[model samples]
Target: LRADIYPTLESPSATDWADRMALPVASIMWTPVASVTPDTDIRRVAQVLLDTRLPGLPVVDDNGLLTGFVSRTDILRAVANDPPLDVWG
Candidate 1:
């Protein structure tokens, strides 16, 4: 599978991430704590991505710190197997 194969994405701000927590998104977001973990295995992350029915996950570390972000693309890019970058600009 391609890394960057997200179905729908809406660019929003940091506050928006929280504002839309209960609101429905076009795609599922990784559970804040469960999805974000430093030691979290990418494969497991991918599984979470698949399981949660989301295109990607918000990367967080232990203690609920937002570290980085991860999508299928991020993982695939790590392995140099990413899908084509979306050109929305």
Candidate 2:
């Protein structure tokens, strides 16, 4: 999760803050970013999300177009509504 989501104190101290403000955002963002294509396998995409610990992944097309996005919550909701799998010994 992004650190910005947390609430800050009204009079927060900056003594503990790092000197990272001068760095460009691109330098701090994750590299070789993971993404899913329109035709990407659902199972593979889910696994990637689980492995990367990212809330969601950008959905791109073969032409490198940003079509949409998918998130862990979306997958969980889908699985919750789908029929359960049957198993037998």
TM-score of each: 0.48, 0.67
TM-score of candidate 2 on Cα atoms, chains taken together:
0.67
The residue ranges of model 1 lying beyond 4 angstroms of the native Cα positions read 1-34, 81-89
Tens-digit per-residue lDDT, 1-89, candidate 2: 32532235344345423444456778667777788998888788889998987889999988778899999987877676675534451
Q: Could you tell me the C-alpha RMSD of candidate 1 in Å?
A: 10.8
Mark the 10 consecutive residues where model 2 has the least summed lDDT.
Answer: 1-10
What value of lDDT does candidate 2 attain over all alpha carbons? 0.73
- Candidate 1 residue lDDT tens string, 1-89: 22222335455566755665656644553333446577887789888878876667767666667787788778778655444556573
Give candidate 2 misplaced runs (Cα > 4 Å): 3-22, 84-89
Q: What is the lDDT of residue 52 in candidate 2?
A: 83
Best by TM-score: 2
| Residue 3 miss distance in model 1 (angstroms) | 20
CA lDDT of each prediction against the hidden true structure: 0.65, 0.73
